[model samples]
Target chain A: MTDRWDLSTRLIEPAPDLLVAQPGRIVELAGMAGMGLTRIGYRMLSEASRRSPMAVVDVRGWASPAAAWEAGIDRDNLVIVRCAESSTWGQLVAALCEGVPTVYAEVPSAVRDRDLRRLAALIRARQVRVVLRPLRGELPGGIAHLRIRAVGVVWEGAEVGHGRLTHRRLVLEASGKGAAGMVRQIEVEDAGEDAVHVVSGVVSRASGRAG
Target chain B: MWFPAWSLGRPDAPAEGAVLVVDTKAGVVACSGVDSDVGPGMPRRQAEALCPDATVLIRDIGEEARRFEPVVCQVEELIPRVEVIEPGKLLIPVTGAVKYYGGEPEVVELLQGKMTAAGHDVRLGLADGPFAAEWAARIAEPGTPLVIEDTRRFLSTLDVGTLSGHDDIVSVFRWLGVTTLGSLADLPREAIASRFGAEGLDVHRLAHGQDRVVGPRPIPPELAVEATYEDPLESLDQLAFAAKATAARLMVGLHREGMSPFRVTTELEAADGTVRSRVWRSMSPFSESALADRVWWQARAWVDTGVIPGGVVRIRLDPSDLSGAGRQLGMFEDVMSQVEAERAFARAQAIVGPEAVLQAQPQGGRLPTEQVDWRQWGEPESKPERSTDDPWPGATPSPAPALIPPRPTRFEVEWEGGIPTRVRLGTRWEPVTTWAGPWRLTGRWWRDEESVDRYQIVTSAGAFLCTVGSDGTFLAGIYD
Candidate 1:
């Protein structure tokens, strides 16, 4: 069977633009700090909520509740676990291996490889899913069934007024077992408080590695 | 069901682009169009930061309700009895109507057809209870209805965070590691009751799908009560006493059917072959004593107005607009699964202290700290104080700082020739690779307070959204 699971297929009804995290697999969204990893995580949660109930584990306290609310994740459907330290990583991973469709977490760099493998193995055994978003470093090499990386960002700052950065072109690289290597650039424009307008594949490359 | 973007579709507003509805007082975007990721309860500044193309408008609660009136009226015609949950959401008990319409599918098709004919986009949800039905409708595709066959299994997989009733109970559930409705249902009932009280028990019942759902009360023809005086009553006292007994009998029967009417007609016949009748109405459902008092008043009015002459012989009480007096139950699953969690949570929050739980929303301010507002979760609605009409000059631009230290953490900026060349990040000093600003934001200059000069600096140690105040330099947030 293919490792990638299309989450929309399992929804009560089909919906578009939502990232699906299936049970019994680990998906890692790796990116540099400030590359909108948190924003992407929230977008996934928002879409997933429409399909099935889910929770978020903020191990590094990087997610802004205000931002999460704006991203369309219903506050009533979200359970935010504010991990005070890396010690609570085990507990969060355990929570993911339960019956939930998906669980989002910002995996701190300090987490041991043994712990991550154990978590991944448990998720596979229990038929649960995990979305690992690393805060500042490269995602741990092992345990990832899918890796989505933010390679570079091209930001457009407004020349007028206070010079706010209004638009961004984020180049992404996705690859993993059973997943074809592909490069897609997303147009990230401001829509509203919680909204990040994403038009996928402004630029694309077929089966390539990031330079 | 919930119309996620009902407020954004006014005739005057642009239909295609992103639209953001701001709650002025809190200064947050109350709602947004589906095309945009901006949801309700986001600050205007933050919303603008996320969606630059979005056209922002202040939310007009009156306009939303007024625009929705025609739709509600149209639905009431098809489904004899309909409950307005809110301006966009509605509930119609389909248990009896399902058989009439031939099945659940037909009922949905019938409603959808009528609503679509009326030039409105609508969806349908048919489940065992109102809670589940609303969710089924909300999550249903734009034109289809979601009919739930098994509510128990559907609710079991939902997050406990979706449980509505008491905010503290939900918060406690989160603290206790009860993440799903199934886990909550597995908890001992008495323990939940003793620890969280009636509100808690209600949530537990909802989780287990055991809520007491009192369906729509049908208007029975036998709701009226009558009385005949054995002898012709010559005085007003005799008529009053007779009316009192008849009203009591009517109330007992109405109560047995779990209904109370808002309006009742009282009829009286005089022994001399004269007749008098009048309709009595109350803002609330009529109680036994209140109904009797109204009946007595009708008799007195007839006698005073000379509408009736001689002795009174017969009296009757006819009730109309019979409404149910018990709670409705169905989906106790989380909001994503039920769609009624907000309303349920609002009610539960009222019983518990508001401050005990909170929901983050956007409010007006130039700085990150001033922009996002947090309110007590599920508090009574309040009119917004701030309007989006005013142009806020000197506010920092988009890509809001992800982390704003509860208190500013002092940071050193090695300044050379009035330009920041190097910045400090917790012991290690790194050269500024790329940077923007020295955005001079001068406000409230008349008052002697700490003013700010902000800058966005990118260093090797993650980009920093920092501010320089009169007191010292502070880290506003990290882009990460």
Candidate 2:
């Protein structure tokens, strides 16, 4: 765990004025919790920010784009946490307990022991935003956050509604400005809890409001 | 087409038996047979051509791996010190197994017996080196044995083609005038290795009786139970029962081995002749009952939702992320049930009548009578939070009625504005006891009709109920 007095520099990309000069790179996040958290180690120094607030930027050094994003962490201004293959789960976890946000990102399925404990600590923290990617299969159980993508309908005027409600077919190049590494066309659909239940009319109306 | 034994024929030996090895994209899939004869060639295609009536199965390498699985389990069962060389192969240090079984021949007999009991016919060969034993197995006839002490003389009599044994490698050795194992070993080991790389030296070392021991096979995480049916499983129930039995056996096996599986993977071989696979995970060190339940539930879930189609023949269990003890548990059924239920319910509702169902929901309001309503299932906004903490305004503390009228009642006001002294009940005159101010439940203002104002009231009979003023007072519902 880190002392509150420890100063952390965050790296941000074309971000908030306070975030721009920070020591971390700000990448646009598309999905919810789990998948997003795995990116802290490669993109941001979420692991480093735990022992100390110091970090580095080396996305190009990563073999996998997701790994780069995992390194570009949160909590300490999304600094890149460089870790060797020998890095133990305990180290990343200490950073997570220190309020590191992306510590939960990209947990290997083979994770065990200390890594599992670190995951528990991060989940208990609850303040760290989770990363989300659309599950290729039926959504896995115990997912705290759900993100869905689908191609929506085009209007009579060919004007695609630009809102969380409308999902469109966006052709993402293998290499692009907003590429999520995958070259497939992802239907950018509505995400979050409310979007999932809105059309079902499950939400209760305010007493005074007419239905 | 299934198991055909006719593929084991030799060129000179009449086609009395078969040993078929089919080349796959990555590796080889082999099966042996004694009755049906295969002409000389790769046992697979040649056997198919020879025995048209044979069970011509496209060998599943996975099945071969599964078949080989018991060997590992058997060796580990008897000889505590055995090293695994992939799924179907293993290397024993021999010092221990030979010592324990009294001799290498007895150990070989025990191994052969176990494999035979498991429905396999195995050839036993013992030599100082792993390669020599392997080659001896190829050359040995069924039921005969080879002892490690006589390995030098036995190996010398063997053809040099037995060194690599692979057709391509054997042909090369044969072309170089190498006729016997003794002759191949006579060449300089260094020169042979540099020319043919490490394989040549390995063959030479094996040809001579060199022994370099490796450790015994490490025990699997826990009990891994698998089953292969002689016939395809037709019904989901049978498949589930098989899965449960297999899981139970696997658990017993693990317990006997003094280990526990942290995670369990139960693979269901498709029963309907279709290769459908389903895997289920356990929350804890799953017991037979727990694992069986999961397997049965998963099978039923698949059946109900049509996740897997027609037929299946086998199931495998591979428990990964192994730990001896103190494995962390994640909820299995809670999550599994939700997924299962969603799919099952949707399918059931799809087949039956969606409009036939209804959900009784409590409507929150000041009036105790207006606290509940009914909505058809699948319609929007069916239920809301209705708790006792919030009290209704007009309705008395009396219990509310059950039935609701299709429309509300309209009252003529005797007093100045909205409050009425006299109100007409559903077809008769009645006086209001505990009257609450009217709360309008209005909707679709764009349309002329379908507007409402609900009121809470406690009748003089101490009944707490709600009635709306649309036309005339009709008993809606009573609070219980």
Question: DockQ score of candidate 1?
Answer: 0.07
Model 2 is docked with a DockQ of 0.02
Candidate 1 chain B lDDT trough over 10 residues, lowest sum: B335-344
The estimated TM-scores of all candidates read 0.43, 0.29
The residue-by-residue lDDT of candidate 2 on B245-351, one tens digit each, is: 66656655655554445445546656555443333332234554455555555455445445456655677766542442322223431332222222222222222
How much lDDT does each candidate structure score?
0.62, 0.40
Q: Chain B vs. true chain B: TM-score for each candidate?
A: 0.48, 0.37
DockQ, in order, for the candidates? 0.07, 0.02
On DockQ, the leading prediction is: 1
Residues B249-360, candidate 1: write the lDDT tens digits: 7866776665677668788888888875555554346655567666776576566545567777889888865753322222444322222223223222222323423445
